[model samples]
Target chain A: MNANIPSEVLPILLILIGTIFSLLSAIGLVRLPDVYTRSHAASKSTTLGVLFILVGTFLFFLLEEHYFSIRLFLGIFFVFLTAPVAAHVLVRSAYRSNVALAEESVQDDLKDFIHTDSKKTKDAEVNDTD
Target chain B: MIEIMLICSLIFLTLSIIAIMYRLVKGPSASDRVQALDTLGINIISGVAVFSVLMRSTGFFEVILLIGILSFIGTIAFARYLERGVVIERKHPK
Candidate 1:
């Protein structure tokens, strides 16, 4: 394929950036102190990492082969939409299951909220019994 | 030059996957393992994309899309199962 300088350079640049982000995310996964923090690293960096790589691939095919792909676009959109929601669900499930926070976690606002809500439900149950 | 860069990047990606696998094996809690698994899925997607580019083929686009869908569904299912003991429920009229 005959290509100009910018056309050739951009995909390489994107791939390098994507690979670095993916590596960093992996390191964060291995080194983070807790599940919550690890989820942060895993979801955010990896999403972006995959995005960059997909974008790079799209551009490579577009320029090198003069062909456009709808699948790549769909993949990009799907990853962007789903990755964060999946992470949120994972963390929320962990919290509801009473996963312990790190020792460095100083405050828990959800604890009081949950306690009061449970008490109010119990009171409602007693009044119904009466 | 480009081929060499792609090769080196592939090596780096493999190492990163190995590092994530370490967490997958060593995670103390179920959520930790799940989180690592989610990250592993994303890593695999990136790896597949890079591999397709390196090989100058577009046949793997469908594979990338399929992995993304399956991983998201798996993460949601695991999260629901963890939040409650059941992933699906039947409702009865009162």
Candidate 2:
């Protein structure tokens, strides 16, 4: 295998970028408040980081003409599909269970549900009284 | 061969882990601790992947699978306990 400057240079660049992004994501994860926000850090950053690393691996192997480069590509594809789905399931479960948000949290779209819920209970009590 | 960048990123990850660990230890609420644990679990998975690359072996693939499975199970258990306050079922029939 011939060692070309361009082929070797690109993957190394990708690896550095990916690693930096992953580090930033982790830092965000550590600094964020509340479960929801933290999940954003863990999910999004980890996904991008893995993609970057996988790309790095893919390029590394491709330049070398190794057969296992395909395996690395497949891994990247599967992870991209699964990571977001898993994150959604976890976050939705948390929401369904009515986990409390930070006190400073604003823009709660679910507030209407809570309001209408209590109103329905009050209406039920009034009807029962009659 | 960006070994220097890779090592730097590993160090950064370690620092993040320390912060997450602090939350896990000092968390006042059950959910917070669960979040920390989940983050830690992901970090471990990534760390193993990095190690596998560094060692130039695919043997760590099993470790990745094991960690993913256990972390998923553990997260579900913790979430259940958070919602229901129990980790195991009772023998009494409904």
Tell me the whole-model lDDT of each prediction, alpha carbons only.
Answer: 0.90, 0.66
Q: Write the per-residue lDDT of candidate 1 for residues B1-94, one digit (tens) a residue.
A: 8888888888889999999999999998899888889989999999999999899999999999999999999999999999877898655324
lDDT of 2: 0.66
> What's model 2's lDDT at B16?
62
Model 1 Cα shift for residue A82 (angstroms): 0.3
What value of lDDT does candidate 1 attain over all alpha carbons? 0.90
lDDT of 1 by residue, A1-130 (tens): 4447678689978998999999998999998889988887999999999899899999999998897989988999999999999999999999877788888888888988865875787798689767
Best by lDDT: 1
Instruction: Give all TM-scores, in the order shown.
Output: 0.91, 0.72
Cα deviation at B84, candidate 2, in Å, is 4.3
Candidate 1 pairs with clashing backbones: none
Q: Looking at model 2, give its docking quality level.
A: acceptable
